[model samples]
Target: MVTIRLARFGTKKRPYYHVVVTDSENPRDGRFLEQVGTYDPAKPIESARIDLSRVDHWVGVGAQTSTRVRHVLNDYRRATQAIA
Candidate 1:
């Protein structure tokens, strides 16, 4: 199954994540189909970046998102909406 999830990166104590599309059986930071966004918890929630068009495309093709990724997307949407 294909899933949209976070691939952890960055040094210890300073976490960064790439929101990637990958197989559900793959390791968390293993091979991914494509990167659709980025998450940096060290910064404010509003600082996260996502390519919504790409996400929509993946969803249209039947990709599912992880729980945390869903929250991040919601938060990012709210932040952008608040600013616009």
Candidate 2:
């Protein structure tokens, strides 16, 4: 089944990840359907940069985001909306 998840990349001690849409059976760093965004944990401050518009687009097209990805989206939405 197809799903959206993070794909590990980079070399040696430093690591990077790509937010990709791929098959569940594929390796974490293997082939994917599309690259939607990226995540960098090596920065002075940890951060995740996601294409929210693309994410919404994919979800609208019936692409299922992983639990982690959903959390990111949910957090962003909540923060932007400033719900009490």
Candidate 3:
């Protein structure tokens, strides 16, 4: 099973996350199939940058998204549709 979740990165004091797709059995920071976005927790506004098309592709291929990722996707979809 493939899971879409966050992969931790960056220095000890400052952290960032890569929203990634990986096997459910893999470690949190282990082997991952694709990097779809980034999350910066420390940003004043709590920002995330994502590739909506890639996320949609993964969803189409049966990747089960984490709860947080689901929220992000919802926002992304709303924003894209509003623009379109």
Candidate 3 clashes between residue pairs 3 or more apart in a chain or in different chains: none
Local distance difference test values of all predictions, in order: 0.94, 0.76, 0.84
Q: Per-residue CA lDDT of candidate 2, range 14-65, in tens?
A: 8887889888899988999889877776652124667778877877888888
Candidate 2 colliding pairs: none
Query: For residues 1-84, could you state the per-residue lDDT of candidate 1 as single tens digits?
Result: 999999999999898999999999999999999999899998998888899899999999999999999999889999999999
TM-score of each: 0.95, 0.69, 0.78
Q: Which runs in model 3 stand beyond 4 Å of their true positions?
A: 44-47, 75-84
lDDT comparison, 2 vs 3, better candidate: 3
lDDT order of candidates, top first = 1, 3, 2
Better of 1 and 2 by TM-score: 1
Among the numbered candidates, top TM-score falls to 1
RMSD of each: 0.8, 3.6, 2.7
